[model samples]
Target: MSGDHFHVHGPHDHAVEHAGHGGDDFASQIAVMTAILATVGALFSYQGGATQNDAMLHKNQAAILKTEAANQWAYYQSKGNKQNMAELGAVLTSDEHRNKFEDDVARYKAEKEEIKKKAEALEEKVKAEDELSEASMHVHHRWAQAMTAIQIAISLAAITLLTRKKWLKYGAWGTAAFGAALAALAIAHI
Candidate 1:
């Protein structure tokens, strides 16, 4: 209470004020721990989001490659159909025209082989992209788990601050450690 000024002290503010006076070291320690956990949680959340985005990008690439592979397969099928038609023509045509039809059949067969090879290559690329997407998603999940643990630790810290419970403080520390472990796992991509 000061001239022309008013102040209100909430429970947290009172606790912090006491902490400044060396009255409640536990409160101050919890406050510091909460701040650190919040910072680490934010970083974990960012990493989770980044990994999710990477997964989506890789998935999209896989889809595009799959479509290209499908198109190649379709082209190969069309060539096969053309080859069948040429073979039919060679069997029904006169000797003079038979050789020309046979040549056309051989050309179609070669072209189909090339198209098949291209389609198989595209399929392989799709598989690779899909695997990349899955790996990114796994990392993202690990980050999310780490973030969840950190959030729980933060909540526990707040509760401990309010109740001055030693058990809750220990729980918060344990949860924070678990979160750090998960974050390490994410970093290692394991």
Candidate 2:
């Protein structure tokens, strides 16, 4: 290992060879990665908004169903003295309450028909909220799928950009952050 024109051997570092375009490619990669991450972030925000809207809708719907159920029970309880209890089936399943039950059923059916009409008119009624919330959850899930595609693409591109083994592993960690955020939001709804 003489100092006079000595030769030393190690890994043939390609760093210098690719170093010429490294900065350019790195910038390009960073720009693309930024765009993808921004898109994912925007989608996450959108999903959050959707979830809020859906939760409000569900709360409203639960209230309406609760009210309707209470009203229905009250109607049965309001069987007054003006109409003989025997003629108006006090007990729904009593065999002796046949004719009265039939009469009460007809009246109840009429009320139901009226309620159906009202419901149809008020499309925004809270009655159908649970169904709407269930639907929102599905949409959120699909949105997450779309977001996943972006995450995957970003990760692959990041891997390609990262030559260092340490950075390569770290890239995966960064990519997973988006998925973890989306999962957290989704589980909140559940």
Most accurate candidate by TM-score: 1
Q: Determine the C-alpha RMSD for candidate 2 after optimal superposition of all C-alphas.
A: 10.8
lDDT (Cα, tens digit) per residue for candidate 2, span 1-190: 6678867554555555556654575557565665766676577657756765776678677677667766654553454322344345565457765866668666666665665555454444554676677767665775565467456746655665655444654565456565665556565654
**Stretches > 4 Å off in candidate 2:** 1-22, 80-127, 164-190
Off by over 4 Å in 1: 1-20
lDDT by residue for model 1 (22-89), tens: 56578879999999999999999999999999999999999999999999999999999999999999
What are the RMSDs of all candidates, in order?
4.9, 10.8
Global CA lDDT computed for model 1: 0.95
Lowest-scoring 10 consecutive residues by lDDT in candidate 2? 79-88
Looking at model 2, residue 77 earns an lDDT score of 46
Structural similarity to truth (TM-score) of each candidate: 0.89, 0.45
The number of the candidate with the highest lDDT is 1
lDDT of 2: 0.60
